[model samples]
Target: MGAAWETSRRTVLRGGVALAALAATAGTAFAKPAGRRLPFLLDMVQNNPGEPLFSSRFNDPATLKSYGYDGQVINEFIPPQTAITFDSFDQRIFPAGSEGRAWVEAAAKKIDAHIARAHAAGIAAYIFTDIIVLPKRLVELYGEQILDSKGRISFDRPLTQQIHRLMLSEICARFPGLDGIVVRTGETYVQNVPFHTGNNPITNGAASHLTLLGILRDEMCVRANKRVFYRTWSTGSDKLTSDPDFYRQVTDQVETHEKLVFSIKHTEKDFWRTIPFNRTIGVGKHRQIIEVECQREYEGKGAFPNYVIDGVVNGFEEFRTPSRTGPIGLAEVVDNPIIAGIWTWSRGGGWRGPYLQNELWCDLNTWVIARWTRDTSLGEEGAFTEYATTRLGLRGEQVRRFRRLALLSAAAVLRGHYSVVHPMGRLMWTRDQFLGGSDKDLTSDYAAIVAKGRVEPVLAEKALAARMWDEIVALSGTIPLRDHADRTYLRVSARYGQSWHRVVHHGWEVMLRGYAGDQNGRYDKAAMRYHLARYDAEWQRWQRLAKTEPSCATLYQPYSFGPKGPDGLYNADPDHGIKPATDHYRKLLSS
Candidate 1:
């Protein structure tokens, strides 16, 4: 439960979002026209006020009229997997009678209306049903009385297939034009009246449940041409971010199926520390690259408004992570690495109150309209986020930072050897198994791979090194040796240091030498030559990276990196495995 998603669950389910209800609407209102924008985004949560896809925030007539929303991402589409027993965890025993069908029906209707309204408003909306969170519908199908030798519910039962098929069919049939579904990697299931709170959990493993979900995404969602969005979360079990190989495995695996969008979510803690790792992946699959912001699991929900780190700001528009606060992540991370837009959670608190500024509905409208229109100037006219702090609040700053970061992060991406993305800042945790991990390797290398069966998250650092120095060399604006400072804004800034990148390349070289050994003394000679060559060429490459890398890292410390955990395959409870990886990352930084 990366930050409990600010469950205004009580507010939403009980009284519904009343932000707009409390505002005045008697006067004639005229909304400003939306500008040309590309990326479309929306919040997915339960009981979000405002009509379905719309937000119940920003009721001011001027602001209200100007804003338009993209979509509604419904929470807990999960067929509850709450285990009556631990060993029977992955068993898909949930039946598809009233509860099953009704769950889908209710969610679909809610989304159907949301999307319809957005479409009607000339805006598009997407829906994300937690493939993991729905009632462990598996148990319902298997019958509560059944259990295997280990007293575990069995996924082998026929009821599992029935539930899967039923849920899949309902998903496609329900929302035809959904923008996409964020296929997370866990189960934070819902509780029914009869079920005990003990049945509820903060996190579920990335195992059979997630695998079933993967099957759903690839077989059903992908086949239906539905977009599959993955929030990379394997850092807990696997050192995905540090080891380029591990991160690549995931990208390749996920890319093999569906038109996918990936939100790389492990950088908030270190700020601009992760971009270099991202650029290395070369934007595989052309996946809509999403950077994560507002670490839900770490930071107290709505307790504060944390800004996107300064160093990473440069790369946002070029290689951006999505933001949940009222920040303008949408305007920042564009393509160099494509910015897939941003995700603003809670809208200053939907159920309990609000998370940032506006309500859920208003947030949708403001973000979607701004993004679709791609107009940064709109907010100055009172069209961006609902609650305007200073003249240019966080949203404005985000937009400006996004633009600047895009210029720099891309410059860095162009000239550097890796791209790091920031996911969220906070570290979130729930009691029990969801917080699973074992520190096996000194590198804290962890793995939560559920390919064949079991799932586990470990602490390991993984990185995606960009070939900007090679592949993106051409994009670097060749800078005249002197007065480069003036040209810094031209997608190239000497301020973006290449020290860490050199270290990575040097590490690779040395590690290679380790394999080569000092055999015949030739190994030492060869290593020396390689070292010398790199040493001599280092400064030149730094200039090149400075020129081509995105401006994002320049906004904060260049300690960019990446992390993966249960979220990679399981998507739910994304931050579960980041601690160990962070430990490794800190180790590297300390070194």
Candidate 2:
């Protein structure tokens, strides 16, 4: 039965590829072809329960085609069990009469319908799944065999391999329409899947990763004739994802095949500014896809204007150094044949809550990147102009003015959120959906800045960011857009950004003064009090704007300096060594 299925799947894949190529040839004659240099322009969409439009807009076929994306990655946390059929081996893991089993069966049908829609639209669909996810009952039945001496889930264990093979085979058989499987090996979240648990299967590092990749390459690529988009995101678990040399070490060991492609983020690390470009891209023999996050979770989550086109298409000027190799931006690699695609995360990254009512910011970045990927000649400014003229109906000076506003907004974000003078060394002041100004993260960052005697410069940068935001607000009002609602949104969002940057500036000032006073042994009570008052006033003003403007993103509490904050960065009283001023500020708030 398995042999016959494999034979039939190979035949279908050949026919599908040939038909797709012919269709592409025919379609290109009429319209500009997409994925010219980068053959796979894909975007991933996950469910945002709070924002239904987030997923719906991205998943819409018209939206995908309009954006020039030839493929879509459905990574809505759809578990492997959803596609796996129950057999004797599976029954042992997920015994009959289990609620999870029933749920999986129903979810599979929904997934089938979703894939069919993608196929109907001529968009290739790939399902995303974490490796080594199994029913909780599997541990109860086979814990000893599954676990290593250190109690970590062992990937090399016979039982684990057997289950991995079974899951891959079942998914391929059940969903023959799937073009590939996107494998994330770094982290696993079993919180949503009550009945299932997952862990990184490559516990033993490169060798183990090699073993797993070999299995996937053979099973998915060779047998099933499907692609395997092996994501090189290890979340800092070894240098497999970040270090170019380390990445090559692991990938070079694997036998290269046309069906096996490496998906890497544009940054060497997770999506953040100030990090160098991922040098692993265009390296080695395997095809590669550069991952870009349009919404920018760490920056603003599309809550404010945080344009990334200039930085992404042209290397960020901030991070450029003399010793860098190859090109720092995606546009530079357009001619590289090994660079096969661009994968975009239009929305959804980091934790929730600066939920957006207006996707204008996200849409701007997504549309430009998508269009540029199709035609590399668009560049950054060209693409922005096109978007302005074609989408926003701006012409002449209006387009130029909007571009200036966007550039200023992007600059403001970098200065406000990151250290402009210093190489952002391990200081996470803001992340994902939340901004922390008075927290220990910022405190530590300020302490380092103060110690380096760069406090004044940092403050100057912050003030400049605040001023640029003011300019952004002013410029936004002058540019009369075709869409009045969009114009209002840009104006209001810029106002919110102005207020937010003021809060950041004042918040950092408070921390810098506290740290500098502690270092110099001369505490300035008057300065501290003034900055604290300013911070509070700005935060309140930002909150008021947030309440009035629907497009304004939800604000993060800037002064929540309590015990047990994110990553234990605030275990100690954040107000503790920087006292009297903070104490007075706390009292003022309480009163």
Candidate 3:
């Protein structure tokens, strides 16, 4: 399997030329309107350390162009402080002998080379940064003046504004070839940058957001003649960024410019299924781009077939609400005059693993979305079929079966991981890159369902999902592709999905029966004990499978039952309330 995979991997590496050829031959079919092509951008940072294979493949101008991307988004490659020359800032504020000056000088050279490469490939290059980010030295020196009483950087401070203006000016001057700047105000990370500390500056309200956006528009867009892709994503710190009414209020206050564009995630909230489409996308008097993640961070992260093509293009059925007539999908908004493009995170989101050894799943999603963006008339199924035929070399009935498997995989994920019984607002058993194993939320949610007398239906849905995986596994084995590697990968990934769902089912049964027993006063300790034993046995099998098949993702483990444990969900449970249940299971094990 390893040798076959290596051969198939080489075929993909050599796919650039084939992709370019197809784009040229089928140019008219997916041609952009005259004088405008919907700009498609991709962020290749799969994780903090980054994925080299992703960069090597998508960074090529040919690959990006063939994949229908107009530009590449670069962030966390170099810290903002080191992205330009230190001399650009006032000596009094930045200081000539600042701690990372030497490193800054070296970074500028590297950034220059990076931008040059992008331009040479005929692809636009955009840099991303968290707003209010600054050199650690600057924050330390001017902490009192620039930081608020809470120690977070305050945009209202005149000194903070001045520093921001200086940074933007230097960035514009340093990289003339750069196409634009993408600024994120939601979250900030300083873990990787020893010399940098940052905070979200739009803490006050919509007015505060307007203040930051105003500075960005004036500096980067108007005077510098550069594009500003202002991201309206927040970690709920500032509701104004994601709120449609507040988004309009904030954006309406700013003067609109051709260079200023609003970038928003497709979902109203974080990139999760069962959320409303962001009403903010087509709102306000500004052009907007939809952000789509190819490898859904919360949905197996490409460890299995969690195809998003159908959801992205036609709307996620799970997003349907009573107030809203129907789910709003990319196809619905792609034709809006204000909708300028699509930006895809080809890989990377959430925190950490289920890192992938193969890119087939992500590739299918990215390709389909990119193609559909160029031609809004293209159906998701047609695009998927094209990918199977052209890229995977599938023929006739094989293509039909492949499509069924891919589509069913999406349903399996929604059923296995997410709860349809609960409203979209309720929390799920798992979140962001990890599957539920010993998560306390899994037990709590099941307990809630048991109390509501909905346990039987929920278990039935999960069982149906498990059966779908069974079909997926069976279909994967039956599909006889000419490429041995593709066939092997499909079967391996399908089996991984099957094993994962089985473990989840066993875990859910144990929790459901235990909680039901608690609530009903029956306390079927024997049944609970039996299910608990099955959960343990299945988990052991999963770990062994993950080891045997390097492509499979490892499951989240339960090492302890406290706030300081590795699993976030388990740690967050109040006072370890789930302890009694676990203890009962342990006692059963000893007996």
Candidate 4:
């Protein structure tokens, strides 16, 4: 509520820089590659499973032991029983008003300094902010007022509108460095119910919040001209599809004539998420309104096994292997959904804190592979955050069962059934072992069947990101000549870099579920143990591939014909390449 509590992240960031320098002194560093794949910013969020995810950057050490993440807590409802209700984090996420000049100025200082440093380092920075509600000034005038049929504000809607204008002006004025704001889940609960906002359940908010959310969104984009993002679906996720009318009414209102960057958290093509409709929305129309599909967040947070992106099979059918979608089909959908960018809510986004190990924040190669690709991932560090933030609020058996369930889910996906999965957020394993029959017993269970889910056919791993990327040396086709480091598209897509990475500790619980039919801890268990070792070796091999292979790069591919756009072919603007962007990530310690 006041500036007194606000501390510019700059000083804290400096301390982190000093600490990272020390780490470098001890020989911890990323391998500088010759040429990196470009076109997206790998915005990595600070995540760890079974613990609270945090913003641990430079000052704090990156490791898996310090943070036990409790994964992202989405609406994991059991249906009409567990529908996602709404609650306002107006209190928790934003303590007071961010509109006040002092706090605004301070926040601006932190955002700008970080962005400036990012620019110097060769990485392009896009400051991401949460949905910050307006102050009393705006609300006092517009107590949920509206515009008349003539598009004229009645009693007080215009007053509220003016407040938005002022608010947006402040935003634009304060953070030119900020690329956009990631608006948290805003609407969709017509009837109030109980749900967890990051694991802490609370009474759902009134329907008015949704209206206000729409208004905020509309005003932010229309007036401010700043990019706004919001997550639509989550666990037990069919609400949006069930009430498509309401969904259309609300989203249409916000995105009209504006570049609304909608990052749906639905990692699958199941009944619970968007039906690959993005291709239709911007296909042959305006590509600004694009949909980003993620590798399912819950089913293992990419921590389960090796994964790959095969491109869209079909927008409507069960998500399938890339090739199945028809060669030059949706992949070459004559320009429908270029599939936009990806938001890796994998480690977080569930009621569980973060799903991956904490040390992953510092896992250089993992990020290298990710960043080298032209795709957008989420981020955790804010230029200067260096502390334990994302954490696990779970306990004892609950954690155990969660892991067990996850294991079962992994097996199910491997077997081509719906584990904790759908197509958008699908999984991929090595060819040899994937077909080795380890998952041969995966029959579609009745519960998983007859639901809004379906398992995919055996994955075809014939694809590779390295070859795929190199194949695109030319767009539609033409090679891009990029030179500027300060401006590039990829910088806006990734969530990585020592400056932006977050570290949290998470453990791998490989119980003796052992081999097939090893239900009990008995003689069958012996065989289970023997096979468990094999699984370990295989798991490592897969993990290594994710770390070192081309699959990881392709995991978040954001393809475009070239740097500018369809019209920029003749524009005299200079094109920038990948190295300038990569240099941006390591700016803090770079000279």
What is the C-alpha local distance difference test score of each model? 0.34, 0.72, 0.68, 0.28
**TM-scores, in order shown?**
0.42, 0.87, 0.86, 0.39
Candidate ranking under lDDT, highest first, comes to 2, 3, 1, 4
1-591 in candidate 2: lDDT tens per residue? 233223433443454343334223320111122235468899876554223335348877558877888888886676655556446464665456767677777778877887887888889888777876777777777889988887667887888777777778888878888888888888775545566666777788898889899889989999999999999987656787878788888888998899999999999888888888888888888899889998876787877888887788777756455676667787667677988888998877765556777778888989988888877765666778899999899989998788877877766787788866766665355654445543345555666687787766677666667767777888888888788788888888888788878877766666665666667876555655666777778867887898887767776543323354443223323443223335544554344
Among the numbered candidates, top lDDT falls to 2
lDDT of 3 by residue, 153-232 (tens): 89879888888888888888878888887888767765545566687787788877888888888888988999888888
Question: Model 1 over residues 1-591: C-alpha lDDT tens digits?
Answer: 111111222222332122122112211112223333436444434432222332334222233224433544444322222211122234233233545444444544655665566556554455444333334344444455433445443344445445445555555555566656665443222332122111211122334434444565665556777766565533244333334465564455543553556655424222233333243223455355443332222221222112222222223332333442322233333433345554434332212221222122223223433433345334222332332223123444544332332233333332222212223122122111122112221111111121211111100011122222221122234422122422333233222223333433433233223222322232333443453355336535554553465431211111212232332212223333323323333343344
TM-score-sorted candidate list, best first: 2, 3, 1, 4
> Candidates 2 and 4: which is better by lDDT?
2
Name the candidate, 1 or 2, with the larger TM-score value: 2
Error of 4 at 152 (Å): 23
Worst 10 residues of 4 by lDDT: 500-509
- lDDT for position 279 in model 3: 74
RMSD, every candidate, angstroms: 19.6, 13.7, 9.2, 22.3
- Candidate 4: segments with Cα more than 4 A from true spot: 1-109, 122-124, 127-160, 187-225, 229-284, 288-296, 306-347, 353-591
Q: Number of clashes in model 3?
A: 0
- lDDT at residue 528 of model 3 (Cα atoms): 55
